[model samples]
Target: MGLAYIFLTSSWWQSAFNFLSLWLLDVPVNAYVTLFIVNGFIAPAILCWLYSFAMLLYEKIKNKILIPSIILFGAYEVLLIILLVFQPSLVGTVGENYIVSRSILTLIFTIVAILIALITGCILSYDALRSTVPEIKWKGRFLLIAFIFLTIGAILDSFSWTAIFLVIFIKIILIISVMSYYLGFFLPAKLADVLIKDIQ
Candidate 1:
């Protein structure tokens, strides 16, 4: 779990590197391109997380969802690999310096992949909240709550539901997610120990 936590925090490293690249190195990487590269670190972290979710789900339902999860995981790997390999041609708009999906088909595929991941991600979070161990259980709850908000925001954003109220709602959800995610890390040491314990 401790190791998993460290890997989960890999995004922090990506952010740090991106920060340095843009500010200190004066490398004007396109924001989207930088984001694409940064997200590379999340796959492993999320995989560990899905394992946590699938474990709980299996215990409850006796269904072998892990196989599907593993298959989805493989597909995710292939998608990213294909994206990276073909990025020069796959994404890039005229007058744009970095990658952005240039084709409607690619864009559709990207959106579908992301939404599928998000749905499974939420499942993983809910499993965390329901774990038998009390100490780290709230960690899962916090993430669950945050993801609820995030999912709402994402849905709203995806549909171009940009009415003033909806926009504000999304912003509020973003704020809640930020608070909730950080709150999970600030638990009592005993709880932290439970939360950080490896799942395997």
Candidate 2:
């Protein structure tokens, strides 16, 4: 769990680095492209790999939850890969053109991705809450709340730029909240003991 949290945080930091590149270097396009390649594409791939290993490590206890989570996560990764591949086209005109391409194919893929993420998140949250560990429960609740706000903000962003900024702000909050939760709750010996026991 600590390692997972660390990788997740690192991914977000890479995202922050991309943001900084855009803001400070006045190289928005290149920065965005680089960010997409590194943080957006590669980061999620790494996460999927880590999650898979974690699932394997605790298969006996977590299989019911983790198996489905892994499947959904895999779907999410495929969608993310597709998104990354077509990123330039998707964002070609501020996502307008792609919006216009809202045909069955696009809609199906979009829904698949959204559903997988939503399901995986819910399962993870449930697992966290049901754990005997109090710290893990709290961390789960924190992440649950963050994801809720992030979802709302993302929905709102579909309306206007103001909402887009709100999405960005919410994402930052989620990142901070997750990082803090990881450091405070999951990085200690307690979490390590729990994880080791789970694996065993």
Candidate 3:
């Protein structure tokens, strides 16, 4: 997920890659073209991550919904890739710094991505929260918080914020999201015990 957003948000890297592409192919690269390449990569990576995360949480649960949901979303991911390749215009208009238009395809992509993240977060946090172990419950708390930060940061990032402080604030939220994700999985036992004393 971090990798996906880095490519989406990094104009510096995009500019550098554009320069390199122009130098090599004598073709100018606009933001839309750059996004085309990055989105191709990001789409699958996000889907794979979602699947792995879901599997990690839902492995033992005999839920019939998980497999079908994965398949459905996987098809959506493929459709996104096809649209990106064949009908780039439907996605958005080319712009100097970013896509000039937010078409239905873009909206659908964002919605799907957010939906997957939300579902994963809910499942993981709910499963952990219901665990008998105090440590697991605390981990669920961090995971829930992490996903909230992540969702907010991602949504804010989708907008083109001209204000520097908003950009910085979004990055800070994402950083905290990552930290909370780490703690969710590998929180020190002592720290967990300290924080979760009431539960114990």
Write the residue-wise lDDT of candidate 2 on 1-200 in tens digits. 44543443332353455557768995543433533432343234334634654573455666665567567656755765576566634422223211112323333433443344445555666677788876676666755664454344333322323345654675676566556445434557676577557856
lDDT of each: 0.53, 0.48, 0.65
Q: Which pairs clash inside model 3?
A: none
Model 3, residue 76: C-alpha shift (Å): 3.5
Counted clashes in each candidate structure: 2, 0, 0
- Off-target runs (Cα >4 Å) in candidate 3 are 1-33, 41-46, 60-71, 98-102, 193-200
Q: What is the lDDT of candidate 1?
A: 0.53
Q: Each model's TM-score?
A: 0.51, 0.48, 0.69
| Candidate 3 structure, TM-score to reference | 0.69
What lDDT does candidate 3 reach at residue 76?
67
What's the best-to-worst order under TM-score?
3, 1, 2
lDDT of 1 by residue, 89-109 (tens): 443232332222234433454
* True-structure RMSD, every candidate: 7.8, 8.0, 4.9
